[model samples]
Target: MARLRTLFTALTLSSLTHAYIAPISTPSTHIANNDDDDNSDTPLPLIIWHGLGDNYAADGLASVASLAETVNPGTLTYIIRLDDTASGDRSATFFGNITLQIEQVCEELAAHPILSTAPAVDALGFSQGGQLLRGYIERCNFPPVRSLVTFGSQHNGISEFQSCSATDWLCKGAQGILRSNTWSSFVQSRLVPAQYFRDPTQMEAYLEHSNFLADINNERVLKNQTYKKNLEKLERFVMYTFEDDTTVIPKETGWFSEVNGTEVTLLRDRAIYKEDWLGLRTLDEKGALKFEVTGGGHMTLDGELLAKVFSENYGVYGRPFDGQKETDYPREKEL
Candidate 1:
């Protein structure tokens, strides 16, 4: 019995470290739109961002559009495209495009002569979209935004690629890209950490480009300074954690370092397990987590919550959050 218990403990810890698991999802071709062309006075645009290995046209846009209609009738839903559908694998190239999209949207809000001036927007991003937006906001001067919400974002950086065995294709591809000086440098500049380099020469080669990355792109986001700055300017902020979200490590202990060079916030184990939500992290000064919920782990949400958020019915859906207690996350304080 003692030996059996010991084996179980060992296995549990092993699995715990490897807990960040991504879900297999069905690719969606749905686009979100309003029936009428007339714009509303309040342009509460809801933008959706998908995760890594995810294409934007997925169910995310539909989900957010549904939510927007529920909360604010006739709200405009915009699909933030990562790349041109007619193009090739443009993962790295899409960074610049993503930045342009933000700027364009902000400009539209500013220049639209007829629309009544309103709040910036309610942006919802999942996985890589969230992390990418973090980089975008950190690099660009803060923009006007009402609410920023992220689901299963790996704010601290993902470690799963490091542990994958040599035989795994995912591990090989990620490793190959990180090992390449050109590729690794661009990735690191965005405050993204590369994991598992068994070869010293290869690691050194990548580090050679680190200086430029740190000076150029990383200087602003090191401690999440930019993120902190924007947090103060924004109206509301929300982060949703999918408890069993494989993309995010749902740990109960340990403190990971912040993005090197920038005070980008570090990830602590307690912050993960004790968090109101499974994967939500602490915000910079002036920023608050607001609320966190566990349960329907990973990308699944209840139909009712979806209807409540999007303001439309999707039949009887799975509960969006687990059985955790709810907390208010309103940005405005009553006078």
Candidate 2:
């Protein structure tokens, strides 16, 4: 029985790393705002990070960029990509060191011509990308985030891996690498998902061996207070969980952790929130931490939901993407 469970875990994690690879066109071109969009088009720019198996060039992402412009008219949109090419970026989702990738992201954002000087930017993250952006915020938020919205992200971490075929070579390879020791330095440094693979069942192992989630989630004994400080500055941190999500085991990882080991512990009741780890408690206190729910499986967002999500979260002065000026936006809307 134990062996069967291990095999299942290995295949699931393997496929999850490779799922979501979308079709792409031109992934690198930055969509300009509407012709009339200029410096005064928006008070804040927007940044996005896609989940694993996805490339910046995906048609869906480009449409998202175009949609941002239509919704906000002149909003600037930049989707963070780890690699220069679509294939490379997709490959990055499975390989490469997550810490290095995030550090590289920090440097890239700091070097951005406009982003470096912007007062703040609104951010949107998808799946694993959501946690990565949270890492960015904790590690180095040079251009701090005013608002952050994430969809179907494993924010807390995953114990049960996603589904993959038992016969897949790739899945078999992942089992070979992870089954013996997911805690080994090689696996932690190499496998992207392994970095955040927090098995609540093995609490000590997760805390001691987890390379990414532990640090970013501030679950380690030695905490980085800056992570808390930086995150607290956000005007709002919105999280959306897909109710029928099968891609992320125990899907509640999106709203933090759905369970601790085999026990279900709500976020508000967890120490991570009660103690203000990563400033989640602070954000919640100020009504900045929002827990929202949606229908469908992971990454199954429809047009109306996308429009509502974007329009409500990605605009200047914490306003929706509607054509209203910052001052003209209603104060009650922030709630």
Candidate 3:
């Protein structure tokens, strides 16, 4: 029985990886489960962006994409990698190339005859991918994003890896690469507020300024501009976060809360796991529509569990894809 269990574990992980390794192609026409609802346009393809620790080959994007395909067949999905996955060499032009990639994705979708409709192409970015998307939305002025979802992503900035305590739930599992102070420094440097917005006053506006170091509430920038317009009107925004996520813990993670005895009208927005942010309202784009799932590790998102979610919430056909049963995806049966 022990041997059998070991074999199952190995097979399950292998299958999960294989599902994520499949190649990406152009957007395809897919009918929503609610066929009677409205078929005016093809369902917008779902794009899955990989996180920092893992690449397209072995990451959460592939795992989620596998689940999505099973629940909704023919759903279009793509993996956008700013850095090379296998080779750790930094791309000299990672940021610029990423901007180009965003344009290319939109262009590809618009040019596709089957997918060139109002159906909003949604994006789900994991970890740094989420932050990168935020940078794009705030700075590059890419076309309007219909909907956005992020999983275990550090929307603000991540600094908790450097402070991992032995008591923390992630201590044991996050022993190697994640515990590295160097990795933390690398992510921290990338998340400097100036990278996205420049205006010290407008947190979103600061996205324009490339290399300025100023407070979030810069007096000069605030007086300089008022009522800043959103780059792209976001229709739906979802934050799906993992509890006990080691990569970006709550306190040191750069998420801000309201300051006492301060006249600042804009609430000090502190970042939380995507779920807590989503649970606030029926759904608002300011980190709204938060959904929470406890105990799923940073790398593996159980397909069976997400399938259940899709079935219950979205009323979509939630099932296993790629011949791997949903039961096989969960590291723990109860989770």
Q: Which candidate has the top score in lDDT?
A: 2
For 133-206, candidate 2 gives per-residue lDDT tens digits of 99999899978988889988889887755544756766665466565678878778877777888777788988
Q: Between prediction 1 and prediction 2, which has the larger lDDT?
A: 2
As a TM-score, model 3 comes out at 0.51
Query: Would you estimate the TM-scores of all the predictions?
Result: 0.53, 0.83, 0.51
Clash counts for all predictions: 21, 2, 12
Top model by TM-score, which number? Answer: 2
Q: Kindly list the per-residue Cα lDDT of model 3 for residues 1-335, writing each as its tens digit.
A: 34422332332222233123223322344232443244233345665565533456554456567666655555566555444544331221122233444455556545656435434455666654665554444433233445566655554443233333556433333333322321232322332211322212343433333332222122233321110122224544445545455444431121221222222111223232222222222233343333344564443455554564333233212211122111211121222
- Give all candidate RMSDs, comma-separated: 12.8, 7.1, 12.9
Worst 10 residues of 2 by lDDT: 326-335
lDDT values, one for every candidate: 0.40, 0.75, 0.39
lDDT over C-alpha atoms for residue 277 of model 1: 25
Q: Identify the runs in model 3 with alpha carbons over 4 angstroms from their true place.
A: 1-36, 39-41, 83-119, 140-143, 160-232, 251-293, 297-300, 308-335
Better of 2 and 3 by TM-score: 2
On the 0 to 100 scale, the lDDT of residue 12 in model 1 is 25
